[model samples]
Target: MLNKVLIIGRLTSDPTLRYLPSGTKVVEFGLAYNRRYTVGEQQREESHFFDVKAYGKMAEGLGARLSKGYMVIVEGRLVQDRWTDKDGKAQSRVRILAESIRVINKPRTEEAPEELSEEIPSEEVPPEGPFDMEDEIPF
Candidate 1:
């Protein structure tokens, strides 16, 4: 069985970070994604919302770096939390358990430099150089 999910979306609100009784770090946030489609010569847009969670180091990092309106790419798996409600009814909802996350864009703010909004982290960027067929492929 395979349970993998990948999504790119904007954060709906600032991430909330917490720690479990065992001292495990956790973060939770909401993500919104937009979908565009054409129907009968008309263009329509739809939005989807999802609850996302991350654990440990990933959770701590994301909690500090992410904010409302930040665009991010999340890779993880689907998780369904099940429990009993107050009325003795069974309830369940699905959410993403993020394994990794990457910030693609940051929301414009007065305190931030304009150029920094779209800049990718130096470590994730490839070195600039002319392509050479003779060079061995890093991959």
Candidate 2:
């Protein structure tokens, strides 16, 4: 059976990066997608929240860049996690296992200036320093 999904949405919270006992990195985050529809003369809007998980390279690469309010497109498969609670009741939830993530938009402050160096005076331009989170360098 085919079980793939593609979703574009805003992150509801910053992604949490953690290492499993086996030393594998994993990232988890929440996504919110809005749906708008019209039925006859009525207009309606609703938001759907989803839990997403990414592993290994994808996790390490995106963990720091993903924050609340960031917009991204995720491609993945649906998974169901099942476990027994402390009270012995069974619990299960379907979540997304992200295979890839594409950042659609960065926040205003995080976005780089669009103008070329010639557009601004040399004195007014900010000085460049050591590469930080915004840099494309791999971790």
Candidate 3:
């Protein structure tokens, strides 16, 4: 069987990082995906929240940079966790174990409204330059 999942959403809060007894790094966070649909003659919207986790390098990177309202794309698989409660009843939780994540939105800057700086000028490269393709095997 093959299992895979991909989701893009905004983070609900900052990621929490922890370490297991085995010294494995783990990061957990929540994501919110909005859904839009049409009902009768009006437009309706809703959000689906999901719990996510990353391990090792992925976990460490996300825990260091991700924050609330940041958009991210995650690729992973569904994982189910079970544990016994104080009363001896079993509880189960479903989450996504992230294999990779790409940040889509950056955190807001701390600068004041009038402190924003204009973007620096970048060197412009001219495209469509003439080149010979047959003699270009450099590798």
Ranking by lDDT: 1, 2, 3
Candidate 2 per-residue lDDT, tens place, 11-127, comes to 998898987666667678999999999999999999999999777777876676667887788888787666567777888777787877887775446567233211100111112
Question: Which residue runs does candidate 3 get wrong by more than 4 Å?
Answer: 107-139
**For candidate 2, what is the TM-score?**
0.76
- When superposed on Cα atoms, how far off is each prediction in RMSD? 13.9, 13.5, 16.5
Give the per-residue lDDT of model 1 (tens digit) for 1-139.
Answer: 7888899998999999987666767688999999999999999999999999777777777777779988888877787666567777888778787867878778766776233233222222112233223322221
Worst 10 residues of 3 by lDDT: 118-127
Tens-digit lDDT string for candidate 3 (28-132) = 899999999999999999999999977676777777777887777877777666656777777877777776787766645575322222221222211222312
Provide the clash count, candidate 2: 0
Q: Report lDDT per candidate.
A: 0.73, 0.70, 0.68
Give lDDT: candidate 3, residue 92: 71
Q: Could you tell me how far off, in angstroms, the CA of residue 26 lies in candidate 1 after the best superposition? A: 0.4
